[model samples]
Structure formats: C-alpha cells, structure tokens
Target: MTEAALTISHLSIHDRSGAALVDDVSLSVPRGGVLTLIGETGSGKSLIAQAVFGLLPAGLSVSGTITIGGHESIPASEPKRLAALWREQIMLIPQEPSAALDPTMRVKRQMALAGLQEEAIKPALAAFDLPGSTADAYPFTLSGGMAQRVLVASALGVGAPIIVADEPTKGLDSDRVTQAIAALKRLSAAGRSLLVITHDRRLAEELPGELAIIRNGRVVEHGPSAGLLSAPQSDYARTWLAADPRHWPRCHRCCDMTSLALSAHGLSFGWPKGGMLFEDLDLHLPKGGVLAISGPSGSGKSTLGDILLGLRRPMAGSVEWGGLDIVAMPSAIPPLRQRYQKLHQDPITAFVPHLTFARQFLALEDVKSGLSAARDLPPLLERLKVNHRLMNRRPCEVSGGEAQRLALARILLLDPVAIVADEPTSRLDPVVQRETMQLLRATVDQQGLGLVLISHDQPLLAAIADEHLALGPRA
Candidate 1:
C-alpha cells in the first residue's frame, strides 16, 4: 500500500460557545490519491479543511491531530507550525474566489506571488482558457467564473504536494468544470495528494477515490467514491444524491407573458480595453416570467443582467420597464430602484463587511412605512432555511451559502417588482438549492414578479427557466 500523505485522527472543532462544529472525525489521503468531502453547507466540511491548514478563525477551539509528511502536530497546540507549510507544501483554493483574489493586483502578478514563475504565468492562465489580455486585468474586472479559474490556476501552479480546494468549481460552466477536473486528475497522476471539499456531486464523482459524507459535524458515511455514490449507505447521503439538479423534476412554466416587466432593444456592451462582449442583443422578461442567460466564462452573462436592471448602460440601446426608458432615468430613485433589485453573485460584496446581518437588515428603508421594520423577517428566514443565530454574526463570519440565502431574503423583504439573480444559488448545497429555486418560482407566480437569472448550471436552468438565452464568443 502507498504511504499516507496526510492523516487526521480524532478531530473535533468547537465554536466560541463550546458548540461542536466538527465532531470526532478521522480521514486519510494517501500519496497520489484524492479524498473528497461532500456535505450540506455549514455542515463542518469547510471547518475541517480550515483546521487542516490551521486557518480557523480566532475563538474557535480545535482538538485534532494532523499528520503531513510524517510529522504529526496538534492543530490547537501548533497552529504556526502547520501554517508554515503553506505554499511550498500545501495550498488552499478557497471557497469564495472573489474574496481570495487581490482586487488591486493584476492577475499575472498575483500568480507570481503565489510562487508561479513569471514565464509560467501565461501558460497557467491559458490552461484554464483565460485570454492573454486577462493577465493585465484586475480581479474586479473579471467575471465570477473567470475569477474562479484565476484562483485555481494560481493555487495549482505552485506545485504544492498537497492541495485543499474548497468548492473550486462553484461558478464554472460545464466546459470549464471539465477542464478543472482534468487539471486535478493530472495533479493526482503526478503523485500529489488532494483533499477537495465541495457540494458538487459531479466533481466528487469525477475525482474517484475515497469519499466521506459529512452531516451535522460527523462523518455519516465513508467508503470508496464509486460504491458510495452509486449506493449510499446512510439515509442523508441518499437524500443528498437525490437532490442533484440533474434529477430535479421539471418546473412548469406558468408565467403570464401578456405584459412586459423588462425589455431591452439593440443592446451593445464592451470593455474599452477588451473589445465587445455582446452586441445587438434583444431581450424581454414578461410580468411573472423567468428568463435565464447562460454562457461560458467571461462571456458577459452577468453584464447582460446588469443592463436589463438599469445598473449598467448599453452603448447603443434602451432598457424599458413599465414602458418607461429606465436607461435614461437616474438609477437611485427610491420608487424605481426599490421596484428593481439585484442578487449579486458574490454575496460577501453585497453588504457592508464590518456590520452584522441584523443591522444591515434593520437599516434597509421599509418601502411601506418609510421606517426600518424587521417584522416580516422571521418567516422569510424560516422559509430560506437560514438560522436566526447567523443574523448576529458579521458577513465574513458566515458561510457563503448562508450569506447567499440572507441576500435573497433581504431582496425579498423589499418586495421588488423584478429581481436579477446572478448565479444566486451557486454556493448553496444541492438540497437548499432546490428549496430556494422553488421559493423563487412560487414568489414569481404569486406576486407577478419578473426574474432574470444568469447561471452556468445547465440542469438548474433546464428545470426552472421559461426562456433561455445562450451567449457565446462574438463572430
């Protein structure tokens, strides 16, 4: 048998209140093997990965023995020693690519700082299909998928012996996801050990090795990936696998298309430096309609949604809502602005980082009474499956999926006439994703609200969308 590259035994983690987050879990990754951890959001999957790298937040206590390269260390006792192994020995591809990337630095520069040689940077980006010009662009300018690829490229280029990728394919399209999997397979083939944490069953299935199904802070199922995924032993694992979007029941399209909620004509947009993304595009979202936009990374799916919402200007077109040219009106007017809302792809950037969620929710101007009232908040939280305790924590403290649900809840509270959701459920687990999409469909049906969705998830789009628009490279 091949020697173990990394081993964890009797691992447990606790939050500040002495609540166990990860409970007595043990796992091993042999050299040249891949180990995947699949579970629901906030089920301690990320906590385990954080503990492995000694990057857990302050006030969280850990009791764990992590062995790497034959050296064993207690996580709580020797955090610095574990952290010292970063870059050269182990690298982490974080869950939120936007937060992990440096906003001010160019892409190539960031890769170089990650220990990728200058000459290798171009080839690395190219491997992910990133354009040559992307090397000079700042992180803020890249699409969510582009940013994710950049992070993956940077981390993998460091040649670390062990890699812990947390939701590495979160926002990628089908093609890009396949590319990522291929890259990871190559790494394992070259004798590097990988510990991947994700909610994506497709990713788990592709990286066949050891699979551990975690639930409520414990390893409920552990076995070979092929056998377990094909026939899970635990009830929770069965439910999770069933929740895959591929198996989702097709949603009936019941929207009234008689009247328009949003429309765009002769739309054209492009970056000054990168040339045009899309042009002469026309779109319509009827009252209570669902229009989904899909495309490869950096194809401007989100940009199109932004144009329809009046958040951005198309170079040569007009966007109309309720027969008024919203493109010509000021975007900040309360009446118009409140009627149109957006759910950002990166929920972390959607709120003030320093403030708690409760404060942010309370600060929203109540459209009905012109006062901040959180009276309707409880039911919304319950419907979204968000715990009330999370409201007290700051944005950075919560999981990405939790923050996404909160963002949706906040938008729902406004009672908007339309919502432009940019990959809103990408961070959520499969089960929660189905629930949230169902809620959105119900809301649209009941309130006659229009929805403009941008996603790379083909199964999800197939299950939910009324009309689909696919964008691609300009001819």
Candidate 2:
C-alpha cells in the first residue's frame, strides 16, 4: 500500500493549565489528494496545524505521532529537528500573509530564499493569478489578496510535497476567493498533498477534496466533501450547512436617505509609484444609507475607505462630513474621526490588544459608572452572541467572530453618525456572516447612520447595499 503523504495518529495537545486543546485526533492526507478541515472558530483546527508544524504554545504538552511522506513519526517536542524538518519538508501557508512576509524584502528575493529558481517561481505566480511584476513589489504595497497569493507562491517555490494552509482565503472578496480556489486546485492536480483548514464551508464544498468536521477538539464527521455537504450526518454539520448564506432568508432593509451624511467630490488618489489609482472618483452616502464599494483585489477599495475616514488624505478631493469640509480643517480630523468610525478587515488589530473587552467598552463612554455599564452591555453583547465570560479576557483569547462583533459594538458605543467597514464579514463563517451583516444593517437603519461597506463580495453587497460602486482599472 502507498504511504500517506501526511499522517497524525492519536494526537493530543494540552495547555499549561491542563486543558485539552486537542483530544486524541487521527487524520491523513493521501499523496496528490486534498484534505479539508471545516470547523467553527476555536474548534482546535489551528492548534492541530500548529502541532503539525511543531510550533505550539510554550508549556503545552503534546502526545502525537506525525509522519510526512513515509518518514517515521518524530516527537514534536524536538524544536531543532522539527524546525529543520519544517523548512525542508512541510511548507506552511500561514493565515495572515501580511504578518508572514518581511515588509522590507522584495517578493522575488523572498521566493528565492525559499530555494526555487525564477523559472520555477514564475509559473506558480501565474497559476495563482499574480502578475509577473508582483515579484518586484514590497509586502507593504500588496493588497491582502495579493499578499496571500504571494505566500502560496513562496510555498510552491519550496517544492514541498505536503502543504498546510490555514484560513488561506480569509478576508478575500469573491474574486480573490475564486482565484485562491483555482490555485489550490492547480496545486493538488499537480500531485502535491494539501491540508486546508477553514471556517468557510462554502469554500470546502467548492474545493475538490475529502472533508473532516471538527468541533471542540474532536472530529465529529469525516467523508467526501460532496456527500457530506449534501447530506451531513452530524447535527453541527447540518446546522452549519443550513445556515449558508446561499440558503439564508433575505430581507434587506431600505435606507433612509432624506439628508446628506457623507460625500467625497473630485477624489483623485495616486500612490507614490503606481501613479493614479483612481481619478475624479465621486462617492456619496446619505443618512442611513449603505454604499458598498466592490472591486477586484488591489483596486483601491481600502484606500478609498481610508480617504473617507481621514486615515489617509486624497491627492485632490474634498470630503464633506455633514456639510463641513474635512480636508479644509486639519485639526478637526481627529475629532471628526470619532464620529466617522472605520472597521478594519482584522478586528483584533483594530482593538487594544492589552485591554479586556469590558475595559475597551468602558473606554468608549464618558460615563464612569461600572454598574450602569454592566447593566447596559450584557444585553447588547448577548444580542451579538458574544459571551460575557470573554469580557475579562483579552482580544487574543477570543475567536475572530467574537472580536469582530465586539469591534462593531465598540463603534456603536461611540455614537458614530457614519461608518466605513472594510470587509467586516470576510473572516466569519456563513452563519456568522449573515448574522453580523444583518445586525449591521439593522444598526445602520436604527441609528440613521451612513455606512460605506467596502468589500469584493458581490452577493453580500447585493444583499445589503442600497447603492453600489464597482471599482476597476484607470481609464
């Protein structure tokens, strides 16, 4: 019998406090085949991946046998051996590309460091739908999707037979998501083994692979992707499938656009090297209106959001906030920003990492009454499905969905009149995505606040946006 490309037998991992993060799990990825792990946030999917890479948190106890490509199982505790094996054998496509790449290094040099020739790297770049010029660009200049593709390219350059990608398509728009799926498909077709971990069941369903359903550190279900998605046996899997956005009930709220809220006129933005990203672009979001900005990756959606929120200045334009020209008043920018909040793609980074959720919430308000805050915050927290138990813990201790909802709650507490949410639901599961967007939509209407939703998701935009702007290359 042919040996599996990657195998984990009776794997268990425990935290310092003796809590089992991963309980006795067994899985395998056959050579040239794809295996996907689908689970909710905090279900131990990432811990499993970390275990395979021998990069688990300090003080954690691991009892596992991990074999790669017919090699004997190596104890995961040996850091030097695991580090060497990791570099030479198992290629990891990390969750956040921006964090993985060196900001100072050129993409070409980084790929070269992975031990691949330019000839070998070019095709991989092309396969991932990245331009040849991407190799010459700095990590800071690449959009989230572009950076993600570069990471994939770097892994492919190493020519490792086994690839482990964690949330590879997280925060991408539909276009970038499609490109990522295509790239993964191409990689698997070329006889490389893949272990993809994601919360996006839609992504799992679309990929050509077997599927494993994990919940609370256990694999509850395992089967072919088609069969599992079509008729999931487990209750959690069935609930997850039923909650997919494609099957979600649609009831879009109409925005009240009786008065002007925010507007940008003659907006012309140009990067230092890229020249003009957009010229004379006009945008308007009325009171209680939603204007979704949709575009391909690297097409300046986030840049436009930055300009609107005063985080970045446009080359030539006037942004009017409630009839006041923000560009004309530099000193007022800071105060006005409080009223026009921005929600980033990664909510955790948007938060104060050192502060607990309760502390963060208190910081938003002028009222110092703890009793009042305790009485007021829980109902809203419950509405958003954020556990009150997490209030004591820092942002890093919470899941992505929880962090995102907490961020939204924070913005709402500030009593903002307008909001610029950049891909707010991109990292959440389908159920959470629907819930969060619906909640956001309801909040916008209830507060009569203007919302500029920037994303690449056409279906999501269509579902909630009252107005749409499609961005593309310059004329």
Winning candidate number (lDDT): 1
Backbone clashes per model, in order? Answer: 0, 0
TM-score of 1: 0.95
Q: Model 1: runs farther than 4 Å from truth?
A: 331-334, 365-374
- Which structure among the candidates has the greatest TM-score? 1
Estimate the overall C-alpha local distance difference test score of candidate 2: 0.80
Residue clash pairs of candidate 1: none
lDDT of 1 by residue, 1-475 (tens): 8788889888999876687878999999988899999988778898888888888876678897898867665564468988888887889999887778889899888888899998888888999998787889899999889899998888667878998899999899999999899888988888889999998889999997999998889999999999999999998899999998889888767666669888888999998877898989888898888899999988899988888887788898888888888777755434688778999998988989888898899888645455444678898999999989888778877778888999999898888888999999898888888899999988988888999889999989999889999999532
TM-score of each: 0.95, 0.90
The candidate 2 region of ten consecutive residues with least summed lDDT is 364-373
Report lDDT per candidate.
0.86, 0.80
